[model samples]
Target: MSLDSSQLSTAHSGKTDLVCYPTSHHILFWVNTVSYILPPIMTTNGNDRTTQWKTTIIVSTSLQNHDTSRMLLAQHHRIRFSDAVKSGSIVFPQSGIAFLIINPQELPENLEEAGLFDKIKKFVTVHRNSFLLLQAPFYGKKELDIMSVIQHRFLGSNLRVLPVRNNTEIVKGMLTIAKATSKPHVDSMRDRMSLARAHIIESSSVWEMLRDIKLG
Candidate 1:
């Protein structure tokens, strides 16, 4: 059974086929990303360089050729899809790779012709150390179905995939966390400053401004 992008998720359901990538990192962090700009990385595989969650891959195929977006990921070298597969097999990296955004529902015909099933089997040969960031639709139970496919394909006994879908639920979740962590009383200037600082930290950095500041 093949998994689609939406099938990608971190939810657990009675020993799910797809395992969410594990870690103790930020939603987005510095990675050895290729392509280097907006939505730079296409995929990532990891073993132990992560403790919680690491955003290592991005499905910016549209931005694959977009160098500005590619460079932002920190690493300079750009690994391609073809390089990912060697001798008709996928190999995991020693250190965990990050941020792999995949729309697995659709795969390259060349890859399929080369035997996708066989290749994935070899790739997941028990703790192969690869991580995938698959895409998904909306959010919820739909993730379970998406993850099921990825789980069955890989052969690694120790490989685990973490799933996250971009949706309204995520937004609501962040807001919920903020309220839970914050006190209702905003009675002082320091508290106000703290709130402002929290907002600044929580918000996504404006990349354009960051890119400019990085130049000097």
Candidate 2:
């Protein structure tokens, strides 16, 4: 779960069995580099019996950038980027770390938005081994507000959040979050109610407050 590139590099070489999962909106140069260095492998138990296990890296990006992403990752034949998720043209693998890169601008404004939220939720639900990594550079109240809504909803659903400001941090954060093989318990009623009350007191929004209550 460590983010250190050197550490991850070691793991990628099979020195240690530690696996890192990265689901990104865009495939960074480093990501493309790593995929080539580490082809996915099936680990076995002490008895030398292969398990239903694999480590992967998935990057999802927008249709507009789909071509560009593919070109960048072209040298790494193992890496694939597609715009098929929206059209239901894609089929996810059974087990492996995958990167889902999507166009950030195409993301829904909130969890209630049509198509976007449901599509993402369905993807994550089906890929129980998946962990979502949302990225944005928020420099204003409006942007932060949007992130707050996303954070509240996902956190309430027991998804871990890691706020990062740079590529290094993003890589580190994703690895740290993905190492856990279990889903966290859903937020308790008291915790949910407390969040709702805080939102109400802050006069955030009726919708946001109600969303918290519903999640509880």
Best by lDDT: 2
Q: CA lDDT of each candidate?
A: 0.34, 0.38
Error of 2 at 102 (Å): 6.0
lDDT of 2 at 134: 47
How many times do residue backbones clash in model 2?
Answer: 13
Whole-model lDDT for model 1 versus the true structure? 0.34
Give candidate 1 regions above 4 Å deviation. 1-101, 105-116, 140-143, 152-156, 166-216
lDDT per residue (tens digit) for residues 131-173 in model 2: 4444454335544564566566656452333344444434443
